[model samples]
Target: MINEFIKNIKILQQLKDNNVYKKYIEYIRYPYFRNLAPDSKITFDFPVTFLVGKNGSGKSSTLQSLYGCPKGYSLGDYWFTTELDPIKEFDKNRNCFIYGHKNNGSVNEVIKQRIHRDKNPDYWETAKPIKRYGMSNSQRFSPIEKDVVYLDFRTELSAFDKFFHFLKFYSNTHKSKQDFLRFYTNKLKEAFDTNKIISYYTPNRNKPKVILTKAETKIVSEILRKEFESIEIIEHNLFKDWGTSIRLKQKNINYSEAFAGSGETAIVILVHKIFSASNESLILLDEPETSLHSGAQKRLMSFLIKECIKKKHQVVISTHSPFLIENMPNESIKVFSTLNTTGKFVIDNDRNYREAFHELEIENTNKKIILVEDKTAQILIDKTIEKLGKATQDIFVTKYLPGGADDINQRLTTIMEITDDTYVVFDGDQKKLQKPVDLNLMPPNQQDTSKKLKELIKSQTGCDVKFYLNGGDQSKELKEKESLKLAKKYLEFYKRNVFYLPLSIPEDIIWDKKFAKKLLKLMKPEKDFSLIKKTSSNSKELLFNFCIECYGDSDQYESTVLQFVSNWINKEDSNFRIVKDLINKLKN
Candidate 1:
């Protein structure tokens, strides 16, 4: 299901790039916003995007900015000047943002600034574009005309939680207080049993109705993993000045939000709002995973994607949930990182799931870990794993350590001690170090590290380790010696676990003559291979230059190149077989 979702998202991305599926707000840029660097821009390439980062990294601020993109919405609705937090009118650094939307086959930019007025303070209104050299002003446009539904899950409370926990009762005695609660509970039960609208005679009359449709009930059930006969909402004097309460009925069981799980109540409200929203509305969700379990979060994301496709809605979410971000296309995710020098958040738009996991400090403990020398090698192995099907892909995870083979080799003992399921892989160029004798040929630091590893293994097992680098072949003399059988046991562990790539380096496979030709045919058909060969000094340089020429020197160019390389390695070739065998061993 996740694979299909990702494939559909990729198709949508292609359509968006071709201008076939136009988005209301194409891109947003902020020259000076709170905690964000100057001139930081984020493009809404996909209809559904995720803004992910640590706490206080401006994720919610970015979501607020998007919420303010459509007409009739303003950031001041959420962020306003208080007594302690005031906005200065004469500040040198202004708070403003600019966004572009598609207008009749062209993009029209609108600039909004926080201007202080006598009547309205800290108000964001449309302002004239700032003049820049060599730039001319076309016809200005107004804010986008679309309905917006902004939901901050963190602040949302179930109808029951809000009423009982926050509201004040007139009775001061304990007995009177119990009677107050019983009166309200009985009234809510009567309303749910009769399936009738309940009204309250407060300063402002209020009536709550059952808003869930039959289809919406099923969706809510699936998302929350709960089956309900019926669900109703009641807003009466009991919840006056608070909010509505939800009454759920399940096979001989009846309860309100007071007894139901928090996640259940949140999903019920979320589904209702989404189903009732108008088509093409801009839906902004802040931390939708607030109370949802992992499974529920994924189902909610899947439902959001399906609804976005159906209604032509633009959905943007700010979250810290890996489950929500895992199945999303890398292009759909925008990572925010704080810079130490400036103490501001900077956008990193080229991160994949593994990199995002590292940023979030999340570890997939269920999957087997395969450690590689660098990012390129990791990509290659990951692509190969994908070809073995979804089950294989789900069983293994690849992580790349920086500083190449030396890093893994230096920390080999520590890594082994940490997890027995972990396996180390190196580039084919480092295959020379497979033999113990070759340790002497390494640099001084590496030689000392290798000696320490050897000594440690011998001391622990009381056996001298030997490496049969070539398919674990043992000499006749060594095989006959029963005394060295323990040595063979140690050799078998390394032989079975450690591995090297089939090619000398990642560039060799990525820039192979045949693979490079195929990639060029798709990316740049007019450019010949001779141009790349003559200009580049080595295979790595050739790969880099080809990517630059084809995709330009953008932040996404490197990932674009690796994606193509991964596709090339996904074939049923010698290298694929080698990687597949290694993965099978790990699986066993």
Candidate 2:
């Protein structure tokens, strides 16, 4: 399943880069919207994009904006000015957004604004382009013509749940309505059990039936990890007014959503809606992870991707689930953050899984912690650990701190104090900090204290503390000794846990002449190898440009390039041995 997911993602990336998804909304820019900065732009480079952030960070708002991008859809449908939450539109802050889509081999922009009129109320309509420098007075285009489906899973409820939980039923005056509900409920159950369709009329003067479908049954079963013989969508007033319930048949037993898990019902509805949508439709999902466990969330994501690719649909999901974003390209994930200065939401484009995890404060449950300098180092260390086999991989979780070597070194003591099982790996360039120090030159009195401290460190941490002394005056010496006394435990802990990569930096390892040639051959065999040497003197920039050139500046470029570097390092090279020894030390 994982391999299939990877393959599908690659296919999606290729399609995106090739511009095969013609109906995709290219990008959306907020000139003025609710709590969003002026001119905040988010590009849609992948068929499926995940909008991730803390609650109220505008993730759902972003989805609503997207929902309004297609023709015949309006953000007003979801968010409109009410007495409690009124949106006052003025000349300066009119609450509008602009989006771009490809038309006739050229990109065209459309502006949608909320217009408050006497009769229309809070209606969203296409407005003339806002004047800007260098803007062309071209003919205006309507919103991209496409089918749009917006599902807010957080608010999705089965008809049975809605009626029984919210509607009036306990009053004696409503006894007849309650009795009718019970009669229809029993009849629906019997129909489900007997594999028959049943119809019922409602006060709305409409008749609806419970119809079974094999395709929906298979998809819902695969996602929810259940074996369903059949699935039915039941629409009847007994369940709720103008709503639907799901019925699942397993083995010889049949159950409505009233008896099934919420996740099962949600998945059935989601699958039905997605499969029923037209090709090249726009699908927006808000918190699809609601009512779903991690495994089900993963399967749901897989199903979504498959459907998107098969139907040429564009999907944008607002979620906080790591499972939904797992295996997705970094370019496909847009993280939202609120600005401290203005308290407005902003979209961050250059982010990956590590940043998302950090921003979301997702806890790592692994037994061991591996801290590194940056994202590249985190990737390298994580991939190397994977090469050490599943046991080693499962035990360790790698995290990269923001600042470079200096910040990590500054926080080493605090980190060690927090977790004894923590290990730190620095880029090979930081090996300069590992210089040896001689404590023999200390005076007899200081030497006596040092000896006691060393033994204390050894006894407590099971590691040797080697003092790296520098030549200085007595005042400096006294200060150094006192500092050592205060931080002796972590210093020894660091000596035991700290290790460095064999290469100076990830760029050097990746752009090594031989390694670069191999990567070029694998990624673009037709390109001349000398082009690498002729590129920028800065290896990092050169590698970045190389990846962009080969991969067409897509979101997967970094991961695609680093994946080769990690794979090469995982081989039986001298660097691999160093990584192996580092892991062995952590294991012991």
Q: Name the candidate that leads on TM-score.
A: 2
**Which parts of model 1 have CA positions greater than 4 angstroms off?**
18-23, 89-92, 132-138, 166-179, 190-205, 235-237, 363-588
The lDDT for every candidate, in the order shown, is: 0.70, 0.73
| Candidate 2 lDDT tens digits, 1-588 | 999999999998898888888887988989888888778889988889888887889988888988888888889888887889888876656888888898777888898989888986879998877685122656677889999888888778877777777776654434665575676678666554564555454243123444547877787777766678877876555554556777666776666787775666777778888888999999989998776755678888888888877899999999877778877889988988878998988898757765665565343334777888877777777777888889888788888877666666645534553457777788887775443223444355643455665554444333453332211111334535754654555545666677777778866655565666777788888888667557777767677767765676757766765765666675666776777788878887
Across residues 1-588, which tens digit of lDDT does each residue of candidate 1 receive?
778777767766666677664557888988888889888889887888888887788999999988888788899998889899886544555788889898789887887789888898978898776764111565557888888888888877865566567666565443554576676667667666675555544333236467578889888877775667777775655544556678777666667777765676777778888898998888999998875655678888888877876777888899877778776778788889888999989987766654665554333366787888777788888877887789998888888777566545534423332346667777887775445333334465642333454664554333444321210112334323422333333334455557778778876766667777787788888877788788998777887777776767756656866765666665666767777787888889
Per-candidate TM equals 0.60, 0.61
Clashes of each: 0, 1
Relative to the true structure, candidate 1 reaches a TM of 0.60
lDDT of 1: 0.70
Give the C-alpha miss distance for residue 558 in model 2, angstroms. 40
Q: After TM-score superposition, what is the CA distance of residue 337 in candidate 2 from its true location, in Å?
A: 0.9
